[model samples]
Target: MWSGDELDLDAYLERIGLRENPLAPGELRADLATLYAVHRAHTAAITFESLDVLLGRPVALDVKSIEGKLVHGRRGGYCYEQNSLLAAALERIGFEVTGRGARNRTRGDSLLAVTHAVLVVTVDGEEWLCDAGFGHQGPREPVPLGRPGADVEQGKWTYRIREEEDGVLALCLLRGDTWRDLYAFSPQRYHPVDYVVLNHYSSGHPHSSFVGRVIVQRPGDDVRRALVGRELTSLHPDGRIERRLVGPDEILTVLDREFGLRLPDREAEELVGMYLAGD
Candidate 1:
């Protein structure tokens, strides 16, 4: 179970900018429309970042810890933290939510380990891929699992779930003319404990990509932006990318202004020091 009962539902909803929306149909319901709205709003409000991992801090997967850091503290997190919080919210709202472990496919033909966490929600007998933690190029709304290979449009971005061999589903994004694979997941259901294992490897292992670098991503309707180490890349939907170096002196400023992430003074100073030392 995802410990939905322990989560502060009001605070979580408010953090995602959904509690005050006038268009909400009375209360949150276990339906497709509500699922779509929650997914869209969550991905828009919370960013995808690995700051804590880079800072050598343990990434906790408990709903309460996640709610405190992400909802109350107004900080961002990577896949496990992001999707775990989301799964708890959806489960609290009475939807059928489950977890899936996925492998990153963006790094060409390399066979990477399954480290990413995603959620599957079932609404009225229809299943949807509700992943709010896939970083900048991730889908803003739920991708239909029933209809694989169908193009689903979220704002200006297009995404599709392709059925691969052995009951595996690959999530792909349209980059201009190419439908590039983002990640792939099998049918085996993963639990929170499984994520804790994946989180450990990702947050502390020397081979982890998030272990030694600053990685932050925000998906937008027009342009998606990512800050990796000292380089900031802005990706447009038309396959155009603009890259620039962010100096140690301005890293904190860029994080606050560009990514809407303002860390505490002490953490900010430490991060700057890391960049200054070229770590």
Candidate 2:
């Protein structure tokens, strides 16, 4: 059930260019799934970068700020910004969405509030987990919760979900015979402030990857590419990076050309110089 206070349905429908209200419960199940797919494609198509931090600007988490980035022809964002916008969209389309916190497996079990925003949907007497954030590990479709084993696909990857203690859930990928942890969460409710605190850490913590690295990723009609600290790799439909880059000079060109990212002149110079120094 959606209320005007929780979601601006008109604005959300307009944002997605859907003429009818999507959040009407009966139609919401499929509509919400469609919205998640739209968000995943939208986020994947746009490259992630910390250019805002580089420009000495703080990232905004509101709907206007989020819609502007996606619609106003600007760069895509990291998890917090990406997932928040998706949550708003879901709410407007008539899905019951509440913000929740997840302990990122990569960042260790730190319980950092709601660093990620995920959608919980009730369909046919069951709840499901829907996430279009998490970059490489983002869920392409909603995975059924309360299930012993469930499979969800995003791009070329398949994720498996397993039940944990109490209501907590663990999501992982099947790596041959072994499972790899991506992240874990529960149905715990959270507020916007939770995301605010985590976003602050993600952008400011010295040990955080975003603070120390320049990462950008984009997907074309046929290929998806990522640039991490001067190395660029383009993956094909077969999940192979046909081209592997080795220098900063190439990274700059790829950021601008491949990802539509505009780096500051000084930052570009510093990166190129650092790459040349072989550090």
Candidate 3:
């Protein structure tokens, strides 16, 4: 179960630019509208990155640690940290949040391991797929579950949930004229301990994509951007992708200016060193 009780809800709301508390008297309701607003605000504010793994640090999943790093420390994290913090906040807000494990279908024909973490929130007997972790190409708002072939438009991007075999569901995005699969998940419910195991592989294993690479992404409404290793790719809604290589001298500035991530002096130097050494 997500440790919702341990989360500081007020601080989290403020971190996501919700200055006034939503839970104030007559201010908010734990419904679909509240869920959409929080989910959109969270994805817009916090970026998706895995800097700690490259720095040889363990990515902690506890709510307190996550708040310290993401909310207060002004940093970004990968899927596990991002979605865990989101799950806790949603749970604290009295939403029925269920954790799930998803496979990375974007990789290719080979079936990948279930390493991605997502959330399903039920409101008024309706389930919505609320994922705040899947980087730039991720959906900004909740996609209605059990409604296959229904296109949910969030800003300029469009997404749909497609039904697959064995009751699996695939979240697809509209790219030009094609609907591309982002990721897929079974109906199996996952717990916090399950993510702990998945996070171990993603954050530490040599074969993991987060290992020895600088991966940072921001899911913008109009243009989504991701910085992987040295290449910076900007994706537009019209299927136009602009990619450029970021030199070592410009990495920190790019992170700050583009992704809104500014590391401390020590970590900055360490990250630059890693980039220089080709780690």
Candidate 2 local lDDT, 87-189, one digit each (tens): 7766665556666677677565565543555656655567777665665445556776767576665555566888788878877864344566767788687
Encode model 3's per-residue lDDT on 160-251: one tens digit a residue: 99998999999999988888999999999999999999999999999999998889999998899999989999999999999999987899
Q: What's the lDDT for all of these models?
A: 0.91, 0.62, 0.90
> Ranking under TM-score, best-scoring first?
1, 3, 2
Comparing 2 with 3 on TM-score, the higher-scoring candidate is 3
* 53 Cα displacement, candidate 3 (Å): 0.5
User: Among these predicted structures, which one has the highest lDDT?
Assistant: 1
Candidate 1 lDDT, 1-279, residue by residue in tens: 999999998888889899888535358899888898889989989989999988878888888899989999999999999999999988988999999999999999999999999999998898899888989989889999999979998888999999989999999999888899999999999999999999889999999999899999999899999999888999999899999999988898899888889998888988999998984
Q: What local lDDT does model 1 show for residue 125?
A: 92
As a whole number from 0 to 100, the lDDT of residue 150 in candidate 1 is 92
TM-score of every prediction relative to native: 0.98, 0.73, 0.97
Candidate 2 overall Cα lDDT vs. reference?
0.62
Residue pairs in collision within model 3? none
Q: At residue 240, give the lDDT of candidate 1.
A: 93
